[model samples]
Target chain A: MTPNTTTADPLRKAASGIAGLDEITFGGLPAGRPTLIAGAAGCGKTLFALTFLVKGATAYDEPGVFMSFEERADDLIDNVSSLGYDLPGLIADKKLVIDYVRVERSEIEQSGEYDLEGLFVRLGHAIDKIGAKRVVLDTLEALFSGLGDGPVLRSELRRLFQWLKDRGVTAVITAERGPEGQLTRHGLEEYVSDCVIALDNRVDEQITTRRLRVMKYRGSAHGTNEYPFLIDKGGISVLPVTSAGLSHSISDEVVSSGVAGIDAMLGVGGFYRGSSVLLSGPSGTGKTTFGSHFVNAACLAGNRAIYFSFEESPEQIVRNMRSVGLNLDSHVTAGLLRFESSRPSLFGLEMHLVLMIRQIDQFDPAVVVIDPISAFRGSESEIHATLLRLVDYLKVKGITVVFNNLVNGDQDDRNEQSLSSLMDVWVGLHDLEANGERNRGLFVLKARGMSHSNQIREYRLGSDGVTLIEPYIGPHGVLTGSARIVQEAQEEAATLERRDEVNRRKREFTEKKSAAERQIAETREALQREEAELLALETVDERKEQILTASRSAAATRRGATA
Target chain B: MTSPTTPDPMGEDGAEISDDGIFHFRLYVAGQTPKSLAAIRNLTLLCDAHLPGRHKIEVLDLAENPELAAQDQIIAIPTLVRSLPPPLKRMIGTLSDPDKFLIGLDYSRPTS
Candidate 1:
């Protein structure tokens, strides 16, 4: 529901090659409208305008004209040569044309009704000569100084803008920051077409930082904050915090956190390949050790990894991790791991982000680890926002990130909670005391779209890198260190004693049964002997009676025989 | 509307009905804008008072004859060009001031 006049017509746009600028402006500046870029000297006003023209000529195949009122064409070429833009090549290829508009107020005479017809004619001729779709009037204020102040100046300025618009050429007009609510000293702010972009280069505490703000953009919705920008060998790049919406494709591919035990704690044996992981712990809780494990694992998998250590230098990190048995030098030599270590305060927070992103893009790392993001001494909210942006960027590119942060208290780092909320896996590491022993414990607080263990494992750090071990859960509570070892030993001793007691009782019962069997056999032999003696006595008495009966044998012989 | 046959209001000062030296006047205008109308009226009055019937005033509507403006190098509208004279003189803007108009048209003074 837009009621704008140009809204009815399709808004033509020119793509500016500066990083994050097009995203903020919703696809670059409005086409055919004069965008006034105002800022102080050395704020990259000229660079911004020149980069726009050069990028247009080289990338879009759109020829452009650069009408400079300040620098000569040779100086302009030399100034931008360091950025690797081939100004002469573009000119030779008929993609770019530069014109030096020399103006001197002393030589100009305002007699009779005189229009700025000469300028219009020259500009029109230049635009037509190259079929330019883009034009840059760098430092339009210089022309104002050359031509002394008058009503004609303002009207002429308006006419020039109108002429550029009618010619349908996208124009970038630069001006110096005027004092007290003015866009330029000449007060030709009203003459600028639909957009006004302001550049800021400021130094705080001996640290220089550049910022870009889109003051106004008609017919488009643009990011309104002062995004910190960097002007290095790559030219101007603005780090926009959250312009990247949640449109990145979801990946189910699991990647190890480099620690097998830590992977076991995750739902899918590892984290999603294109997810963010937060390893927050108090100081000396093996945060970097965990990060190193991830980096090492990534290298082992033949995937690239970049470790940004704000607390330690590259050599120091390599040496320290080597002491823990994590040989990062091999990975570095193999070009699989890049250790980018610098002091957190070496530059502003935004500069660090730019450098980090540039490195990531160059290295094309699959995993990025920022060991202890809390080392940045910005405000709490600022740090949180920065972390969110970093995590968001890596995730969008499907680059897994393991951010190690140190928690100060018994809980998760308060400042990192907001960022932690967006993390796919939040593994909080903290030093705990149990059974008169202190040790580090790691637990997965949350793992979206997967099942993760809720148990906290003792995080053991040694020269061979980090390992997780089960803690003692006994009547005295979860125990660790020598106390846990002692308790486990005691339990083992009791189990052995139970086995020994059962074996000894069985042996005693077997020996008693054998003794009882011998005694019963002796009793049976004695009873059999008594019975034999009684039977012999009875036979002897019967024999004597038979002898007496033999006297009367004749008659009893038959009976005896019968008997 | 006043016809050429009608006597001029400022006849007592200088007004005659002779065509010996006919002065020609051409006023360029896009349309009947107030400024263009003013320039026409002012130029006509000056011509009538100074040269009376000896001058012929012609008005060119540039809206109808848009291509004619380029010939006299007319950047501003309501420009007056003295084409009949050997050496052409030009004036821009509404010719409200008669003295300036006379000076622009190379008219020395009216000989009453």
Candidate 2:
């Protein structure tokens, strides 16, 4: 093979720490191919690339080399250490090489020909020394500014990419997000690389959001949607929106929600074990009350329970439930119940799922309660798919999860219905206003395997906790919720009772007539038996008289008569 | 005819090449009775070696993966598919002619 004419040998690929990401990019980064990750500052460009390298070394056992042009190695390590990534440890183990190449353009001897040969040498040495299969040149924007003119820098960059590719090491070259309509400072890196990923951070309606897009991946299909990510304690976790295959094993054991009537209405007296139950209602409709009851039941059954509160803090929840008569503090202290309280805005919805799954793994709870799933509605609709995955993850762990949804107004929340299909049971709490007061009504909207009473039960939140009353049923229908409905039902029931009393009197009259008929039949049988006895006695008398007459006619006949 | 144990010729493409450099390939075939597996392997080997490196030889034994025989496309073992390098090509059974394989890969037929 002639020099510079060697056949294009296949490049070694880099592995994405993300599961679906690797699958999308066949066999990882086109081994030694220069992939561009361009995004604005604070747009997670550095985080994404670092996670890629860190996950490669830690998770995939592929050593990596990180050549940072912007931040110092210590700062990078400190920033990411909270995300459960031990960057310092990886460096200590010599599995990762972090090279901070600070370029001072002012101090450079610009008079001489500028070449990246030194950088190439250093990068090569680091990669070869560490046996690295992956390389990340973070914030290549610094290089553009460091090298005065664009022409030399562009050519050098081109050569660098080629050099990396020829060596067959996967490389991630990050560039800063530029002005509108431009990807980076030079805008040429996007065209040079075989794969391009664009990250973005924006505040929509005062809500901060982060999203990532695989702008291009040559020869491979990638998820094209704007995947929302979170800068959380675990670095960055992409929500692989796609389902993990539709083979969720169904369960036959119906699990109870601890409410007898609710379980009864659910058809099988409970939901299927490991199934999800959605408690949907408007504010103050007792979503928490129902969820708390369930958690209490799970804990009482010797199962650990985890309550994720998005609205109320753990302390506030504990205090508030005191009026409902639930002592969550004891459970928490005992470690049977874990209260994970965070604002809905604490992290992206996927992060919520990840963190919840993490907490679940840590606590290994048998029951998980989300006080109100609606708290997550602030996230993009794309999160719905991720939420489904989270639900499945919980179910697969045999954890009975309860999502308390606050159904706003009378919009006939579709979220409840959509989630109900995945859930084993759904309880709807309605707040009805009647008789100058608001009363809560609890109804089992749907329960898959259990037989639950269809009647809406009236309930009240009081010092002792929630009181569920079997509402009166009358001629009109079964009453639920407020006192007025109950009173009207009671009045109708009174009318029905009056009507039943009259009917019962009429039945008694007919029964008396039947008794009199039976007495007459007995008297007739007595008369017949007396008549037969009298006939027999008269026949005997006739025989005796004949014998007496015979005796008088003939004394000797008496002996004959006796004989 | 060469002995059945003879190794397939390797082409010059750094891949094992055969007599036909155009269809440079090698298929290590052990036995006969082309089932589905045989058909796929044969076709792939043919394509990897013969069709612009598109034709590759794939050998399949009838004893393993027994269900391969049911396919209508493949009637025998060791099928080959020469997909690339233009005029796509295919061959069945133990591919016999190196000249034919090269021709399939768009190589000029060697004057014998």
Candidate 3:
């Protein structure tokens, strides 16, 4: 009995080699123990098991044997070839062996007493043939349908698991999910108690998403959340929400917002490197424009950028950006920018995330932009979770990301409030309507660890790109659009009129002073003339008196001498 | 038993004499276990009473040739595969019940 043992030594794990799976499992599946992969039909259980085997053979150098009870060996080889697994090559190299176990119930009759020693011998023989350290029994539950006696099959299955454990080979057993919450149809989960992983293919809102969750891991701590997984040509990749802790290293370096005005508003010159920035607003608020500006700026600076366009195709985005004088096609040609466009309803939110992450990993971009992330068709929580993981992943990689969100008029505040906490900078865009015109206004709502402008700056989209206009603060209120323009015009006219009035009053005062000075000059000239005339009269009288005195002076001179 | 059925034309080596009216049985077993021994004894007794000289039994031990387990698609230890009755049939067990064993082999009991 392999009870949950807490020993000083940790449980050793064999790396599954699937992307993001090891990180979530804290390493990988338990080594030398059977792990039950229970899922409904077509949930990729077989693919998951085969990937484990193939990756073990090629990557980890551990040989594996696949004992299939459902699919034939050739068919399995053909099916996984699309995923680029060279099963035949692996077999030729003696690194892998495939045994297809065909059980026909109609052809076999149970007589009295029998055991599955034949199965054990076949499995053991296959294991020894390649000296395998890993084994995959894909859909082992087919034996239950092939064999009639349930009690005997059950006991044999129990023993088979024990035998596999004694062989010390890491085994993965795929089982069909049972009805009504049972983990497996044949209760195979009971036998493989070391690890149990459940895969789910759920259709939400007409979109299918595949998710994986580790139900139980004995003596190991693993991520319990259902991580979305993608099965493409490259094989299965689980998108684990790696936000186990907020431990990603931050950068003090800043990245440009592409638009100079927007950068100025952020006050830090741009967004912090590796920080998430949210561009949220109502429709037609230039959210995508802002995101494109950032992408264009990043590409211009020789940093690779990925623009995830959910609503528009790459051609459409390029064409639309052309109207704003942003030539993104050149960047695409230079391979400095990549545009990944998909309909939001193409798959679930998690699928979008997985695809985006896959592209990001391939491109190894320095910046990422999700244009209109609100275009994704999913529940709020699912979108939130996807964004959370995406943000965490980008931050961990030091990739600056910009998320464009389109909020409806009424739900603007609520939407911002919901996603605001996850962003390092929140730039809110809105349509300001006044004076019978709608103008785009942009404001930095919150910028963590930096000072940002709270004032809304009116911006215009033109052939030269986004142009920010200084807000017009009037007596009534802060005005924007044509209202602000009209207010500015009125203020200019008023200033002109006041200057004219002052000029007119100064001219009147100068004229009054000049007129008074002329009057004083005239009066002073008249007084001087009167004094000269009086002097003339006095001189004439003195002349007459002198004549009289001259005549009397002769006589008075002698008397005067005596006086 | 039905007058010894043509006086036992075949040799003691149990070689295939002809394809017509021949019941060639191949019993696959791991080793000389009790179940394998029981199945061999029960099959011999049933064949002698029912099929008489028309039956041939071949025992293949998987312990000696383990590769045959996968080749013959064997899962149970004491498995009897009837190859020459036209349509091949497989029965797994010790064959402890005679009536059920005969029915599984599609053989009718001789009415005396």
The most accurate candidate by TM-score is 3
* Ranking of all predicted structures according to lDDT, beginning with the best and ending with the worst: 3, 1, 2
**Residue A438 in model 2: shift from native, Å?**
3.3
Tens-digit lDDT track for model 1 on A88-114?
Answer: 998998888887765544333222333
Number of the top candidate by lDDT?
Answer: 3
Q: For every model shown, what is its TM-score relative to the native structure?
A: 0.72, 0.66, 0.88
Preferred candidate (DockQ higher): 1 or 3: 3
DockQ of each: 0.03, 0.01, 0.70
In candidate 1, list every pair of residues with a backbone clash. A281-A407, A324-A463, A372-A404
Local distance difference test values of all predictions, in order: 0.78, 0.68, 0.87
Name the runs in model 3 displaced over 4 angstroms.
A1-10, A242-244, A410-413, A480-485, A513-563, B1-19, B108-112
lDDT of 3 at A126: 91
What candidate 2 gets wrong by more than 4 Å, as runs, is A1-12, A16-27, A55-63, A81-96, A128-132, A188-192, A219-221, A322-336, A360-366, A377-399, A409-424, A448-452, A460-467, A480-563, B1-112
lDDT of 2 by residue, A1-563 (tens): 12332225443356787644565555565555778888877888888888888888988887999988888889999988888889889988878988887655532322212345446656766787779988998876677676564676777777777787677667788988778888887785644558888888867545667777888876556677776666776567655444545566767765667665566566666677788888888987778877887887778787899999999888988888888888888888888999999888766566677677768888999888997788884533545676677777876777888998888857887665567666767778887665577777888777765566778777777776777776776454555555546677777899999999999998998899899999999999999999999999999999999999887879876667887
Predict model 1's lDDT versus the native. Answer: 0.78
Error of 1 at A202 (Å): 5.8
Shift of residue A11 alpha carbon in model 3, Å: 2.4
Against the true structure, candidate 3 reaches a TM-score of 0.88
Q: In DockQ, how does model 2 score against the reference complex?
A: 0.01
